[model samples]
Target: MIPARSGNIISTGSVCSYIGGGETHAYTCSKHAIVGLTKYAAVELGQFRIRVNCLSPYLLATPLANNFARLDHDGLENLANLNSNLKHVTLKAEDVANAALYLESDEGRHVSGHNLLIDGGFSIVYPSTCFSTQNKIENE
Candidate 1:
């Protein structure tokens, strides 16, 4: 990359990077660190035309998530969708892959130190308050 004077460094993160979820403290902290590293690296490497970014996706039905939630793929998907802000849509690995591809491609040439969230607006919605407010309005 140094020789080419251009490159992209994409790091994986989680929704925990922006908001605390059910994940362990260590897991959340590590995700936060990845975001920080992405920013710092982007600044340092910008002179070399190297871009650094992070992909922070919401919960997925991976083996790790399944183990943590003690639920199978279907069960986990159901749980995640229940709290998701987007209705009737589930996040898939392909979605994340597409985001990565965009970052690596020319379309994202000017994007750096960006924490691209692949969440279906999950991070922006606080489930407790959001659902409680909606329920109150519906009940009224």
Candidate 2:
């Protein structure tokens, strides 16, 4: 398909790819591997105008998502919302789909070799910072 008509590859990862977990070593490692594969694929395929990217979304209220989480639908939604920076809104399948849609669209033509995180800032921020009572150290 690359030679025929420039292509795009959008893969699904997880927030675990960017953040390490306590005991789920195997699952965490697997997701991280996807990132490596996505990057490698992107570099190799770029020459043929084939873009490759991955979408890493947090917990969503789906059977597949719930199975890994071991939580029911409401519990999954609650946990996701509670942890996300955008606490007002819960992550959804539609959100992940939209990200995929954008990545595959011409709008994202130059966005290869990237992991578009749908994690609602969970991986980027530190939990300690939010709860720390220590003195606020200003950057010099």
Candidate 3:
């Protein structure tokens, strides 16, 4: 609260901020906007002892995501596994929540203007073009 003069603001976003192409341009732009807002708010609110951060998670098998992708739970998980660089671990909703908890708690006191990714190294390692190119190469 403003009365407290200290607070934390956490926002959600997609991994599209780092790498986009599988979806529409507008969707990617909005995710990038969230990142920008986090940074801007961090600078603007730092004096008030308010921290602003964003948690960008990759595809998780949620109702909204499932509806958008038109895939079942197993299919969505399979797709995420195939596209992600870290294949051993699957991304769960709780994982994203844990990231939020960290930011909200004292553990992340010094963390601000950060876009903490909950992706399984997907944005860093998986190239947007690699999927299409790899399939083409295999076919050839």
Candidate 4:
């Protein structure tokens, strides 16, 4: 189990965008590494039928962090905004557990080395509706 983790290590180490203190890419990079690790491990473990994968999840509704439950609505929303594009991508433990169940079952029998991003829509972003406007602004 490549433990789904935060990008603290990579974010703190060396990403061109992280000049000052960028926790965003840090955790992003961490999860990215998990994907790479899962792939490499799965390739080696294919002979053994030992599947390897990652369960990359965003901010979940758990008591892992200190004073998280105490946060107000906006604060919570702000946290959800980080790393994910989903407005209110709140994840419950059951959601993750259900995914795990599917992965472990025969449904995922052949699936391996997947960086299953359980983030509501955080990892996947579509083209912006105001792309031209933003491009004009940048050019100006």
Candidate 5:
């Protein structure tokens, strides 16, 4: 995307840099690096018309669902429960695609160096697992 906006100033963000972990010295810090890089690029590229921004999506269902299903059934159940809220509507891949469409459309032309969170209200509630402190193993 940056290359496409070659003449424009650009920004990018990891978006979840603010999330921290338990007994981990720098879990949050590592994620936060995206913010710094984003700001740096924004400042450096402002001279150009190119703009930078990030589209951050959270907890979208993926193929890994089956693997999680294979884990202890309780683990899978726990994850399903974790992904819900009072209203409990998990996000779809289409949701994120729509976001990218909006970002790429004329509507987002002026938007730069912004972290667009497409989270289905999940990040605010389950930041730790939502951003993936745990990765599902590839076992069948």
Candidate 6:
């Protein structure tokens, strides 16, 4: 890509990259590393017109996620939706792909070293605590 003078390097990350999600220490560390790499590489490679970015998505009901969460597809989806700040919207692989497409396309030419979060605002909002408190209030 250095020779080409234009390139886009996109890496996969997780919400764990920005916040703890009860994931394994190694997994969280690796995700964090990906963000660091994206930032550093973007700085170093920008002169060559190479863009480096990351896509951090929340939990999806993939086989690996299902196995890790020990839940079936529907169960995992339910759990994710229940905890998501954006209710009624289930994340899909295609959503991540679309983000990748955007980053790679000319539309994102000016975007570099960006960690595009596809987490449905899950990383920004503490749904677990907020929802629990809401439930308590409703019950009361």
- How high is the CA lDDT of each candidate model? 0.85, 0.79, 0.84, 0.52, 0.54, 0.86
TM-score of structure candidate 1: 0.88
Query: Ranking under lDDT, best-scoring first?
Result: 6, 1, 3, 2, 5, 4
Writing each residue's lDDT as its tens digit, candidate 5 over 11-110 gives 2323355455411336456546666666567666755656666665543345575363455544544564576452555556686667667666788777
Q: Best lDDT goes to which candidate?
A: 6
For candidate 1, give the lDDT of residue 106: 98
Query: RMSD per prediction, one decimal?
Result: 5.9, 7.2, 3.7, 9.7, 6.1, 5.4
- Summarize candidate 4's per-residue lDDT along 1-140 as a digit string, tens digits: 23442111111111211121223445546645666667887787666666776676555544442253356655554665554566655666687778777777878878777766666664355223211333555677
Query: Model 2, which residues run further than 4 Å from truth?
Result: 126-140
Show where candidate 4 strays beyond 4 Å: 1-26, 66-89, 126-140
lDDT of 2: 0.79
Give the TM-score of each candidate. Answer: 0.88, 0.84, 0.88, 0.58, 0.60, 0.88
- Candidates 2 and 5 compared by TM-score, better number: 2
lDDT of 1 by residue, 4-101 (tens): 99999999998878876435567778999999999999999999999999999888889988997679999988887887889899988899999999
- Steric clash pairs (candidate 6): none
Candidate 3 stretches greater than 4 Å from native: 129-140
Cα lDDT, model 2, residue 50: 90
lDDT minimum window of 10 residues, candidate 3: 129-138
lDDT for each residue of candidate 3 in 65-132, tens digit (9 for 90 to 100): 88877799988888898888898799999999999999999989999999998888887888573223
Ranking by TM-score: 3, 6, 1, 2, 5, 4
Model 1: residues with Cα > 4 Å off, grouped in runs = 127-140
